[model samples]
Target chain A: MSNILEVRGLKVMYGKSIAIHDINISVPEGGIVTLIGSNGAGKSTTLNACLGTVPATEGKILFAGEDITHASTAERVRRGLVLAPEGRHLFPYLSVQKNLLLGATQRSDKEGIQRDMEFCFELFPILKDRLKQKAGTMSGGQQQMLAIARGIMANPKLLCLDEPSLGLAPAVIDDIGNKIREINQSKGTSILLVEQNVHLAFGAASYCYTLQVGEMVAEGSVEEIRNNDVVKKAYFGG
Target chain B: MGVIPNIMVNALVLASMYILASLGFAFIFNMLGSVNLAHGAFYMLAAYITYYLCAKAGLNNWVAMLLAAIVLAAIGIVMERFVFRPFQTEFDRVVMVSVALMTMLQQLAVQVSGSQTISIPAYGNGVLDLGFMTLTNEKLITFLVGLILLIITLYIVYRTKLGMQMEAISQDRLGAALQGIQVNKVAMLVCGMGFALAAVAGAMMGAYQQVSSNMGDNINVRILMLVMLAGAGSMNGILITGFLMALLDSVCPIIWDSYTASAIACSAVVVLLLIRPKGFFGHEM
Candidate 1:
């Protein structure tokens, strides 16, 4: 299958300091790919570069056969590249319904938007019940769910989730992992999930890339990454 | 006029005008996270434009005011694009740019209107004489127009999709962008709306009072106090504080002189800020 996204030799810089470098990653059509790393491993930075939030100083980003290296963030989002950013960067004061509606701000197809709204409700029913509730008032897990649901409302071609499992209970993490897989399988949407949680990454993603200190150190199928000695020692604390 | 009724009418007029002007200032402060010191100058400029159109161009008062508002709105969009957006994230630079803008606009107002104090014609020229109090048509019209404009603004802020996007953008800019919101686009519209509202207030006040070069200074200070006391992110706070501040200004004048009224009202604001440093409804920036 053709890749939905391909990043070649990507390098991102923060002033004189480098955030991520020498990064090459791809997400195949209708597949789940996770970039796993420890703190300060440039995982979120990589996702930011993809979403055009942070400029990539060096490299080419091709999405579905088109180069998007210098596109504005809004233009990129309009082209169906979306992110559920790290720490669930929700509009805390807004209601859940407004949050979801904001997710579809780029689109004008009313019917399609309604259909996606229903789909999001199905993916996380708690959101529908708390439609009028402030997003920040929800528990962490529910906020995460709302964050992802908000992303889904955009009906993205490639949904990049940044650390959805962060600050959640094990049970909630498991629930999120299942939702990730279900989203991919059911909608045939491509996903590039950035995670620190190796277990959730292993369960949800078919292909995995291990990032260490802003570099792509390893890339393989889930089983290979799961059994890799270095990944085990570093991420799993073996 | 009876002192009680006079004070009451004056308070209502002041409150409505202050509220209309400050609402725009608060939006700019909340959304761009910057202080546009030029906002007052913009207010003053609108008054001059309205005055020129009414006096020189021979347009009807309402049409002249509307045209002046449109002109300011267009200038507002340009300012947002060239002036405000570039320095949005740098608070110090934003203030500096606004101060420079304020100076330029003030100079322009002086150059156009000449240092002489000019005023717009009364919107209406009649009075309602009741047994208890007399109400001038001018004051009644000013208050009613201001109230109607305030209602429209509230409706736009609370009841529209664009308003929801605005709320989202104010709370979390990057998050709003990730949701595919054109942050700059929304901001530009907000700037236009804000300036338009300022223009309307300026024109209304121009009719109600004499227009001086430094008229913006007093109103700006009052707006700053209202926003500071209301806090950073709360519109409702501005709504409440606008009336309270106006009431203080109006009531104190009846007991003392205008100078003492100003002092008392300002001191009350200072004390309120001392009591709530973050403002009554503000969250952390």
Candidate 2:
């Protein structure tokens, strides 16, 4: 499979402190690729850098072979590199339907947008029922679902999910993981998953990369990483 | 009865102008979470521009008002891009910038007009005699203009895609940006709209009252009170609070001391705050 997104020698700095250092990763088309790491391991920094939320001090980002290193965050989103963000940042005062509509802000194809919106509602039926409800009032799991649904509304070529299972109940996490897999398989959309939960990451992802202190320490197939001694000790607490 | 009608007309005129100014202030506040202390300065500058166009350039009063609104809107866009956008939401810097703007505009006005009050020629010269009272047609026109503008503003805010984007940004800036809404572009539009609205109100008030460098200071206080009383992001609340405050400003002087009207109005706002800090109809805290 051809790589849809490639990050080369990406570096990010927050003020004087370096957040991510010379990290490189590539996501191939139509599969789940996850970055597994501990808290503050710069998984979010890497994702932010790719999304153009945090400027990469020195690096190159190629989306579908088009360089987007200096693009604005909104421009990056318009070009289909969308990030769901770590906190599920939904517009709290807006209705669920409005929030979903906003996800398609860059697209002018009304019919296509409408179809994707219907697909989102179908995937998250609860969101359909609560279409007019304020996003803030939704439960954490429901909001997470809405966040993913909102991202899907963009009709993105590659969907970047930042810890969709964070703070979710185990069953809810399982449901989200299953839905994510369904999204990848059915929609044929590639995904870049960033997660601290190794089990969920390994189960949902075909390939995984382990990050430590702003650097990629290991990258291999899920099965390969699962069998690695260091992966077992660091991720599974074996 | 004649006195009562006169006071009622005055109340409506005051309320309309207050609503116009406060609505603009509230727009910037809602969209950017920026206090926009420079709003009063914008209002003052617009009034002077209207004065210069009509009085000095000999333009028609109505045409001058439109020109002033457009000019001020452009200026507001520039201000947002250069001044406000850079120091957004920084309390001290916003205050400093606003105070500096106010002083600079006031000094310019003083230098040009020599502290003399200027007034636009009245658009409507006659008065309408109702069965109960005599009312100036100018006051009636001002009230209707304000009402129409308010309706238009509401429609633009609630019914349009731009309105949806504004609401989205107000709710979550990062979320809006992630959705591809250009925050800076939206901020410029909002600032332009807000300043234009305030300018129109300033010109109308300048025609009805006398225009001076410091006229905006009084209106600015009233705008602040109206926004606070209505709660941020609540448009309808502004209309209701504006009328209520106008009623207080009108009726209180008849029953109580003239100075007590300001005190009473302020007390009402304070009491409302004590009861509900977010003001009535505001989204939950």
- Highest TM-score: give the candidate number: 2
**Fraction of real interface contacts that model 1 preserves:** 0.75
Model 2: chain B TM-score relative to the native chain B: 0.93
Q: Please report how far candidate 1 places residue A143 from its true position, in Å.
A: 1.1
TM-score of 2: 0.96
TM-scores of all predicted structures: 0.93, 0.96
The deviation in Å at residue A154 for candidate 1 is 1.1
RMSD of each: 2.4, 1.8
**Candidate 1 C-alpha lDDT tens digits along B206-225:** 98987767878878998999
Model 1 lDDT tens row, A1-238 = 8999999999999999988999999899999999999999999999899888899999999988899999988888888888999988899988899889889887889999999989988999999999999899999999999999999888898999999999999999999999998999888889999998888888999999999889888899999988889888777667
The models' CA-based lDDT, in order, is 0.89, 0.87
**Model 2: fraction of the reference interface contacts it also forms:** 0.73
**Worst ten-residue run, lDDT, model 1 chain B?**
B276-285
Q: Compared with the true structure, what per-residue lDDT tens digits does model 2 show for residues A1-238?
A: 7888999999999999988898989999887899998888899999988988778999899999999999898888887888898899998878899899889878899999988888887788999899999999999999999999989888888899999999999999999999889989888989999999877888899999988888888889999998888777776667
Clashing residue pairs in candidate 1 are none
